[model samples]
Target: MSKTWFITGASKGFGREWAEAALERGDNVAGTARNLDDVQELVDSHPDTFLPLQLDVTDRSADIDAVRKAHEKFGVLDVVVNNAGFGHFGMVEELTEDEVRAQLETNFFGALWVTQAALPIMREQGSGHIIQVSSIGGISAFPTVGAYHASKWALEGLSQSLSQEVAGFGIHVTLIEPGGYSTDWSGPSAKRSDEIDAYSAVREEAAKRPSANDPGKPEATRSAILKVVDAENPPLRIFFGKAPLGIAERDYESRLQTWREWQPVSEEAHGS
Candidate 1:
């Protein structure tokens, strides 16, 4: 039984890789990109197995329509990959209100809208997989990518709760926490905040870090995703790079240390 997939941001980056991986494996795919022409080559090459949809994931109505159309075309959606999101680079103080809203709207709320649209269909089918492309920052924060981290953190929380809620329906959720890869994420797709003199040191350091031009490959992440989709019981959280694991462990360890130190004071607020 060939699976059907709905992948957001299919025009490029990890989304494009995921779509190719699925099609190569003989699965049907409906991919959403803001510009249909961005994926015309894919549509032309895989006419029988690929459907390219024009979508802006932040638009709730468009998301619902896209999911419904995919379901109608494929009969069922075995996997729905929410991979449409851009990175916002800035310190908390440097970002404008609009920038903050845009980050949350696309990265957090956009995934929320698409997932909400897919839930009922998957529930009725009694089985499905929802893959959220969260970042390593979802578990730990860095200096300049604060806004991006905030968005992914919210997504992680949403997917965490969603997994528990949908487990009975056999709709498993996997959060793809990968470190920086060679993707447009830190390049053209990434938005930058205006200069603020006080944060210059931190911003300069961030700029020195590798971007999408790094040696790492997005294809590797795509391969990891395929492995998760094929597994009978996929982990709720799967990591792509050792960097993400290192960040998570360090963050958790530090938090635990603080928690232990505060135990007596923290327990005072709870009922005996």
Candidate 2:
């Protein structure tokens, strides 16, 4: 059966690819970008299948309207992919209060608003998928990506709690933790800290490394993600790409090792 996908940030990257894949599979897509004109070609080619909407995921009214329009067009929404977000690369202390808040506003709260808008419709239907395109940073931390990590980590926590809340209604939540895919996420949108003396030394070194926009083996990662997203019963958390899997594995292992190494001390401190 072909599912209906209402995806945010479909102008580029994973969201655009996913929308294309969905349409290729005979699914209907209501794709949104900050300016839907950017997706004019997609919409024009698939007039019936692709519905492009001008949307800012951060805008509450726009979210509501998008959901309404999607439901009106398809009658039911099978999936809502919250893929609209950017990255902020800087040490925690280096980021200004507004920058940190902006990170959360777009990556975390933007997703929340979209999901909140879609939940009622899905609940009424009694089935739907809510896929959040988080990042490996969600599960693990890195040197200059602390604010980015915080945003994703917030999504992970929100999704975990939301999964529990909506499980009874047959609504599913999937968090896609992708590491390095050749997306513009790492372009100028990827924030960098100013020359704050506290982080300049480390920032300067990290700045030389490639970002998500850098050339990479993205096809394999895209293929893996398509398989997961199109699967009948996809996993709650997906770690896509080689870098993501490696980071996830190392993070899990490090956590386990820490727990084991501190078991006795923790037990004594907690009296457990």
Best by lDDT: 1
- Residues 43-103 of candidate 1 have per-residue lDDT tens digits of 9889999998999999999999999999999899899999999999888898899999999
What is the total number of backbone clashes in candidate 1?
A: 0
Worst 10 residues of 1 by lDDT: 207-216
TM-score for candidate 2, residues paired by index: 0.92
Worst 10 residues of 2 by lDDT: 210-219
Q: Which stretches of candidate 1 lie over 4 Å from their true place?
A: 208-215
What does candidate 1 score on TM?
A: 0.95
Predicted candidate 1, C-alpha RMSD: 1.7
Model 2, residue pairs in steric clash: none
Q: Give the per-residue Cα lDDT of candidate 2 at 68.
A: 96
Best by TM-score: 1
